[model samples]
Target: MQAIAERSPLLSKYETFERGLPSHPESIKHLRRQGKDSFEANGLPTTRQEEWRKTNVAAIGRTSFERVSQDTNSLSHEQIRSFLLPDCIDLVFINGRFSHKHSQLEDLPKDIFAGSLANALVQKPELVEAHLGQYADLGHPFVALNSAFIEDGAFIHVPSGVTVEKTIHVLFLATARDGTPTVSYPRNLFVAEESSQVTVVESYGGFRDDRYFTCPVTEIVGLANSVIDHYRLGQESLGAFHVATQKVYLSRDANFFTHSINHGGALVRNDIQALLDAEGIHCTLNGLYLARGSQHVDHQMRVDHAKPNCHSYELFKGILEDRARAVFNGRIYVHQDAQKTDAKQSNRNLLLSKGALVYSNPQLEIFADDVRCTHGSTTGHLDDEAIFYLRSRGIGEEAARSLLTYSFAGEVLDEIRLEAVRKEFEEFLFTRLPKGDIVRQAV
Candidate 1:
């Protein structure tokens, strides 16, 4: 491990990085040590690696980014007002640290606990210590980097037989006044006990026009018969780099659903994995990404059917224009003992420009003969016939193209259960598309 770390220029400053963070409890310290050691062994991934073959991160590796200072709190409320959700419990983070003034945590139920992870470690050490680093895949370099600097993020726990009617929103904002490229590692933990139901929305957005980096990790656990719905929205600055990982585990008869929407960033990579640990579990994953003007977005999904009579489904779509690049790798695995497993995966991409490119791969590994598993991927340009048809109906060329593109991406957006969120996303997409003015005016 030391040999690998010594060869990389970016990792040579690991000791300095470790010294910057504040002190933590022994358990957390030990966990961070493990994470650092794991990072030392693997280092940053390269295109030579199978998982990272299509995505090259050499630019991010060569650049050095400063960690956000603990006392820095210059972000104004108005700066983040546009990104906030109305009438929901919002937990805000500035430069990776929890902001009490910006967050709303009062008037909560007696048995529920929802607040900062850093505070949870102090007030409820045992509760946090038990599940902080339990589900993450430490082998991944980005995950290890996040774990090594696990300082602050959102934390939520719902007890058995408790149902929270309102949604919980966790927002992370990145800003640097000195114009230095900064990095933030935000970790979130969510646990839903038996017979409980909860919905959570996690969002990352840039408040300032700064070239920064954000690497976040989220872990979710669903106990027996629990229902959990999760959504992640990433809208970083054009000069910013973003990478994230999400790990989920579900118990018997648990129902879980996750939707990931990525819209901004210079280079972005997302890895999402789920484990159906017990029988009769149902899991669904849906994702959408929009890339343009040389931007890059990559998504990797893996779902393991470890128990029998479990079902899993995944759908990911992308819209790329100009010289933008995108990647989608979806893998589903059914164990030998999981005889009744039902899994399906699909990846579709729509290219709007000749220079735009996409790599879509869908794979399945089934050891059980009785399992029903299918996977497919498609990458192509917009339908010329459809565009012509719309144009003949009095719509301009640009408007026709924009309408078709909107309809293609709207499939995943329409699946969103929240009316407010769905409407907001529709407006956001209409504003970003080519000839977006036409779409916006029509809407």
Candidate 2:
């Protein structure tokens, strides 16, 4: 414990942060206290732990990051225009606090509440109190840290029987501060009531060449017969560290789909878990990550089938170049009562250089005898035969390689139902490839 305290400065800084916090409701205060206690006990995880054996976060533990108390409104609309998607309801947050000046909420449907979590705590305390800090587990140190500083983020609620035609986009922007490295905890809660349908996109981005820390936690609840499509896009600074956790709970007959796209960050870790609590639930999780330089990206995923007659699918792919490294651990758990549960998980990796490394593990823990569950993982370089075949078709070597890489990544991108989001990713891919114009023209 003393060693952990010596390594992590946040333990001491947390006391000051709690003392200076503004007055909140009793329930919220209790939640913060719980978070503080959990973090104090666990501190930060280390390589000795099984779950974190491969990913080391010693740099994050050693840094003394400044926690901003208020939002920074220094950005103009033009500064963030490039990050915004077309034909969507946009909600922007700067340094973890919502920016009303830049958000567009006029098109929100009736009976649907979409805005800042901090404002919702004041305007609709009951609704905020009911679901806040309910699903996300505090055992993880980062989740506890985010819970300890739960102040502002996106809050979206779709009432019963309402279908949201437009996509709700929540953008979190992190800017660099002068003195010390900064940190922000953005806590989001998304609740879809019974028989409702909605699509949400959560995007994280930072200024170029910035060094900062972003620890965010998002909790999603899908009521009976609800249909939800969620997209989490991470485009942090190449020198930044990002650790995020997303917890999802789906009731009977609920349909849920999520896609995680990671393209930036020096050190990134994503933990996503979904719980199917009742029968007849369908859940899908898909992810794509691209890493280069010395960047490290880790993804940990879990799907719990607690009830019978549920189906879940998971597919994650990674492209690594230079000395970049990545890790993917996916687990599907089936309870004894979860009979007739069908689950499939796959993780694939493409290594662009000899120094690039990947550790992919797909697991299944099934207690039910009458169930079908399959998992597989593959890690290798781009197929030389395929590249040669493409080169023989009058394509340049660089363009052929880029085109094959695009084709490998397109498998996951093609699953995106939103045309605007898909196009945005496609453009991003073109910009990152060598001889991008040729690849774009060939594709």
Top candidate when judged by TM-score against the true structure: 2
**Alpha carbon lDDT of each predicted model:** 0.86, 0.91
Candidate 2 ranges beyond 4 A from true positions? 1-7
User: Tens digits of per-residue lDDT for model 2 on 341-397?
Assistant: 999999999999999999998999999999999999999888889989988988889
| TM of each candidate vs. truth | 0.95, 0.97
Stretches of candidate 1 above 4 Å error? 1-25, 207-209, 435-443
Write the residue-wise lDDT of candidate 1 on 1-443 in tens digits. 34323554445566786686566678898888887778777778999999999989888778778776664357777887888877778898887888888888775677888989988887887778878898989999988888888878888999998997878889998875478788888999999989999989999888545788888999999999999988888888888789899999899999999899998888999999999999999998999999989899999999999999999989899999899999998989888889889998999999888999998989898888898898889988889999999899899998998988888988898888866578778889877777887887665
Model 1 pairs whose backbones collide: none
Candidate 1 has an lDDT of 0.86
List of clashing residue pairs for candidate 2:
none
